[model samples]
Target: MLHRHPLRHAALLIPIAILAAVSSAQKADSIHYDEHTRIFRMDAADVTYAFGVNNVEELEPVYWGRAVAANDPLPAPHTMPEASSNDSAPTVTPKEYAGWGGGLYPEPALKVTFPDGNRDLVLHYVSHKINGDELIITVKDIERAVFVDLHYSIDPATGIIGRWAVIENKTSTPIMIEAAAAATWNLPRDTDYSLRYLTGRWAGEWQLQKQAILPGETVLQSKRGSTSHQNNPWFAIERGEHPDEESGDVWFGALAWSGSWRISVEQDQLQQIRVTGGFNPFDFGYKLAPGKQLETPKFFGGYSHEGIGEASRILHRFELTKVLPQGPMPKPRPVIYNSWEATEFHVDEPGQSALAEKAASIGVERFIMDDGWFGQRKDDHAGLGDWYVNKEKFPNGLKPLIDKVHSLNMDFGLWVEPEMVNPDSDLYRKHPDWVLNFPGRPRTEGRNQLVLNLARKDVRDYVYNFLDDLLSHNQIAFLKWDYNRNWSEPGWPAVAPDDQKEVYVEYTRNLYGILAELRAKHPGVEIESCASGGGRVDLGILRYTDEVWPSDNTDAFDRLRIQDGFTYAYTPEVMMAWVTDSPGWTNNRTTSVAYRFLSSMQGSLGVGANLNKWGPEDFATAKQLIEAYKGIRETVQHGSLYRLVSPRDGSETSVTESVSSDKKQAALFTFLHSSTMNYPYPRVFLRGLDPKTTYAVTSIYGRLSKDTPTSASGSYWMSHGVDVELKGDFQTAAFRFDAK
Candidate 1:
């Protein structure tokens, strides 16, 4: 429905000149074209777009004409293009790509080529209009080494922009790139603005302060850490959508280093514009021994006028696309109960069956058989390499145990730490080369285990097949894929010393490939990623799993902090925080049952305690909590979540609440950190409630001396408040409401 503005006379020459210059340049090696495919390959690299057609032939010329004929008034030319006559360095031109009317969808593609006469790099851009308002930009012939591709996309409907970057290591050597990519926006010079970065422990280094700029515009910046071959760093920027704002300008910049090849991006021209300086792609003189490649961790960034909160929502929507099916897949709720804390390392057929029995009794839907289910895996220090199920633990094999759980009307799950092998195991003894180690150096071990060298094709193939075989043998509804440790003594016998860092990034890529393959083969099975808890919880891993174990420390009190920190980057659905018994195994904090259940309800509600020991009262309370959780599952899972009170203030109490999408109903949970001897009372304010709606409040557990149900409209509850008194070591209460 959208139409481009008619070109004026002055812009006619622009397209002619640009096309002539492009024709004079060397012809690209490959050309691909298709209407349905937004991605095109030219020089061994893939270009992804938010929207576009597949055909390059049909797209290039049209987009070229538009770019050359773009009639948007240009800001004064800042600097003259550096001359090519200088023998000391290559000349460069700074170009500004503009997005106007909020629908200038930008699609970027990449290709690498070695120019005939020069080793220096020159990138070429081609644009396409495959769909309404969807623009594609393809850059060909960029010299490849270890470079990060930073690109941004804007959603036409929402006026929200999403940023994404990919690191392609064309060379075989590994490089340690520790840097952050930032997006800086230029505001109107006279505008006074308040800059704020979302606060949370996981919100990497961020700063906000006011400063004067030239008579042009103010600058807003958001920066976050880089991706090694091991990790990916990403950040997002939001420009609170106000009534007066006209256009939002965003520039993607990165600071990186490859040995001495350091580059940094800085705000320039007093906020009118910014630039990335200090680029030295050739400083290291590094080459990936033929047949090997390493890439910097990719970064995602964008600019939006929808405030930080809505910007987060848009970011999640983009991230969800990478993991969710293009078509509809079963929206299976991952309501799972893990046996690690309940059974620990002492798992057996009878124990698993008993646990499953207890789990089903309390409305548990998925029973995950955690560690100690495989090959003499009696303790954490041994039996890791051996992947076979221990017959002693399961007399008739795991099939019987899994069948038993399913017979009780619950899906069965299994855990595997595939990338690690314990030294005292059969596989390690048979193929010592499976473990990554230096030829003559001592291989360091953690938890009596060593990481598999995924860099080698043989190792990757072995691990991939092992997992495929395991999944094929069992009807696993889900897999608790745990990476229990971090990379240590980082070395690979198969890689040269100079390229050691490449192992980290390559290992992750191999992991992604393996996961991609597994997902394709067994589309029904769901995977839960756990890296000793939140260590590996990032957008990259979220691309592979349905959920993540927020932390191994699930004690209700600890999870208050854990879940609070997790929500900054991830949603509540993805945070698999649970409630378990206390004196807890780790902290020994004997929290009240209600308190534990309330904390667990904030995430995927699951139980990780010895349910067999629960008394009648405990059983009744657990049943009620489970039913209540199921009733509000959708609202809690998909609604907007806000943290009202934090437990980190050393206060004796904390509270959290979730409101329904329609704002018709709200759930409030309050926790008491310690028992109060006299006049113990806690008053809490409810959030996200509809003032017009009236509601009934009641205690989910048995009545306390001072506790009683009360009815109040949302306005009354918000103004007058609700209060509950507790006389126990730990306490919790829940309230529900409905539209009047």
Candidate 2:
């Protein structure tokens, strides 16, 4: 219920404009196909991927690893020889995309049943075409009219490939498609590979988890109708057992869907690893009539030979330059002040106006009034679907508060949960059939709210029209769009029973359409994606939203671990970290104001603490730290991250560094849990700097060691690291270096 901070890509082609940044030599030959060998190869950054059509007419993975020359020798395409009677050629050979028939059974890429009770389906290559940076391959079933088109594209800067599929039913009868996948990724046969992913619950999302890649299947999925926080749709496979932060081979990928999705990592009898992911198959059946078609969400995969740290850096660069809004170079995240904790559901114009003035004094650029601003919402149990300003709370509507924030030199934002409705609300009373429900089943409720059935065209239009009117009438600059609960009784009675399962895909598609329409209508307004703290986060949603709330657990010490795990899959440019009160709401632990500010400054900085309770000393400290953060905001938000020291495995210290794209500025943050056994913190060596250039160092907090130099060459700083003295429990320090 209100436990804490409530309210809490598209096939994305690498734009041709980005090629100007790459070397001419490297850009000349990025993708190639050899007709003689029936093989295709692509190169981006420092990695390469290759595949070929074998004699049996199946696409087989040839090689995938570090970059190789165009003329490098590779194996010719051929069918694998079966070892035993039990291991047939279909099971032994690694097909890039396979159907669910012909005695093949390692998680089929496509499965369907005919109206005539014939389920056997096998696919073979029909044709191929390459247009500049993208490739399209068409395949069809051996004796049926079902066809599938596979799409692929790679980002030149990050070496990450985007994949998706389009399935078309060309037959005259309705076909029941049971399962489908966007793509299947194959890795070389190796026994030492380990899978790394993120997992946690409500208040504990984004916890880094790892396990050995054994002989069976490891399924990671979310059947909660939204992207549940139980398991994020991202993965990394390490080739060796001793891979560290900065030095080993790492392959990573992420799914782009926000609705019910799955990723199956299976090791077959031949010891090869395969990853098949797309829409989840549980309780799923899509009826494809006559000539209708369906498109899968994009899947992205990448490689980094230098290690997991470099893998994250590649993803960060790709997201900032290609995936985000206003790309090639998007604007920096403005410092925000959210009043969720300050005023909670008791928000009034006068209280928010006061908070706005204090927030402006500390350099907050955007002022967000969370929760109780509308719809008789004094608490979480009622008035969710009714999106009107409460007469008792705001006599003159939101304009008075919006104008007040603007006068204080800050923009105004509001919180809204458009996908939920409470049973006690007027909207629910008038339209009882508007939500997802079965005709004769108990509708389960979470957070005292029912999920709106966006799959229905009427319901979808209603949510869009209300939000469009809200923005059109107000002077709002941002919207904190939140989804606080998962779906239950996910049934769409408006459609036929055979198409009811299409709710999973249609609901998410309509949500995206609303966001895209609103964005086109109001170009000045930005949006944030929040779902009970990171429940609906994925590449599919990020294309339309600006920032994300990682977790509701804002404890400074605990965030060091949570934020560390988040960066493995997502860039810090969109990570919104807040600094709340001392006795944390989650853990009841007290930490100094300086420690809290430093922790939040690592990402897009925001202040959510109750300013009314803060004294003069606290305000002064906040203003000074915020000013320092602005100076390094460029490097931290748009630079290369070097996770020098991890916060896992009970380590006493944590360290991270960020270097600007131009290699001219760098920021370093160090944290200490305790000074045990009288041992000093480790010396910090910097990375991603121009060795020949000289830099001047400045400390934002803590004292530098006596031997530390104020000015030195980049090589000297990299080889002979600087040191800072941090003692006691829950201490932190920050340093900034500028090129001279």
Candidate 3:
């Protein structure tokens, strides 16, 4: 049943008209923007708030939330759930353990009573709150407890809107919680369905099934066909299967999926689970002292296809009462070239400048110099703590290279890993306590690195100032902000024992603060979010970045699946996939260069591999592809994306297309993974075309070199379909059509 609570101070709430106007106006504090949404941020007292609005709809509520907590609980051993009957509800029994400094603490205990005759899931937090718009529920002092808080809120005017859940450490001591947060939507039992999931990582198909047990043994049984398991945390289910798609409405809900964990603690320790919604999860966790808080963030639309799509549309409606005084919004980012895989950690001023010159020579507008330019950064083992230019590598310094790039008419970009620290670095040497660590415990390390405790003001200040200093000193046009790894040795010496689980949430909040500050100061610089590859590619970070490095693996085949999975929650424009050389960096798979270039064009196009090694013919091919991309840049960058083929179907080929909003132009790409005998020239169907308009088709690539205008009724294109022929191994064919 729907619950209705009257606004405590309805008169004080901002008027709808004013809120709409404010939402539409671009604010200086806005960090990220798209054709549909804008994000405005502010600091209220100690908490930082990110207010997001969908500028297209004035009636839409603002999407706002904060990270308000940071703490690590005492560690405890975790026991996996024994196989149980499907009819029985899972029971959690908490045991105590020793605290961080060797003091005895209560074992974590939890009892989830799915009482009869009740639809509301009663999550009894040892501590709970009812006042704020958002709350972060967390568990402290325990490492193995699976603690999560679900916050539900609704505005009478907005209906059943936003909801967010904060998952925390449930063990008495430290334990690594490796899980992806997911929400599975449940459609009506009679609904027709199909499922889609990322292959390789997990294997599964989305065809109609009577029953299915996901990776974590989450049973999703349907009486009739239902799309109820869409966003759940799925791991090794089955591999090499395509995600299923269907032709009916589907329902949705969220799920928190976990990986394995190593918990360390004694018995009898008390662990805390806290929850907060709305603003920041870390900040909310901080406000509550060893208890759960039920605060709401801003509105979180819903889980249905229509609901999610509507949320994006409505995000444009909210306005900011206050905005930082930045100038007009920056122009849409250009198709740039990134020197990451090409150089890795070997980049120096001269090398980078040379690469930049070569890139500029080929009409490459932006030259991004990837990692290895800071501190004594060599391998992944050390030198992350200090954020200084390596004079030994950049003898002439970055300014000259940036100046040279500008002289060559290209923008300069740099990479930074601010949230991590290497044990051997100067910063770590000067302040051993700066990294996240318990006073006397052996700190765990991942990739020979440690996570900086952003919960501490000193650490936050240092990171913020370091970035500010770098941006101030350099004429860097873009910042490729990367979070290469996840959290390990999760400890916050600065926070009290009772509030340690809040550290994770706090770390993320502080990150938001740093990004907010940077955007405010450097309004013209574009930020590209990168996480080891696609690890941190999510809507949450999208609010701060212009684009995201879709993955470190730019092989066209791999991206076919990666980009397909990404589209479930993200827009096509935000995904940054690139065309690189083959043999690929790792697989050494030599795909057709045309196939490689065409796949990357689906997102923000970039060249990641060395271009200097190309032969004359290859250079001509590269030039041709670049020219073709430039010709349709607008349509590809801004047009509607339609999935024409499934990568998961184990198909030997895949196809995708982008059609202009005016329906006057369309770009279609068909990829052939391997050779097929007497290959059926699959007449690829088209989407988003105007049947009413006659169109001309020209083979941008392949043997069909003539431009031909073919009359196609819009209704026929939709009902019947257009076809294209393909043959051979590692092949690609593209066609561009415009109204005659």
At residue 211, candidate 3 shows an lDDT of 27
**lDDT of candidate 1?**
0.53
- Each prediction's TM-score versus the true structure: 0.70, 0.96, 0.66
Clashes of each: 13, 0, 128
Q: After superposition, which runs of candidate 1 have C-alpha atoms over 4 Å from their true positions?
A: 1-135, 140-151, 155-160, 165-298, 302-332, 495-501, 674-685, 689-729
Rank all candidate structures by their lDDT, best first, as comma-separated numbers.
2, 1, 3
288-307: candidate 2 lDDT, tens digit per residue: 88799989888899999989
Model 3, range 96-147, lDDT digits (tens) per residue? 1111111112221122111132112212223323333332323222212345
| Off by more than 4 A, model 3 | 1-161, 164-246, 252-331, 703-723
The TM-score leader among the candidates is: 2
**2 against 3, candidate with superior lDDT:** 2
* Runs off by more than 4 Å, candidate 2: 1-29
lDDT of 1 by residue, 1-740 (tens): 42232222342323231222122122232223232222222211111122121111111112200111122222221122334344111112122222111121111122222223223223323343223322234332233443433344434323333333343445544333332222222222322333322222221211122232223322222111112212223223222234211223221222222111122222222322222222122212223343443343333333434244444444444444433332122252556677877778899999888888878887889998889988988899888868888888887888998889999889899999988999889889898887767677888886788888776788889888988988899888888887766555556666565555455446667887888899899998888877665545555566667887766777787777666555544567666767677788767778777778888888778777777678888877777788888877766665656555666547677766767668866776677777756756566667667787777765554333344346778887777666665556567766666665
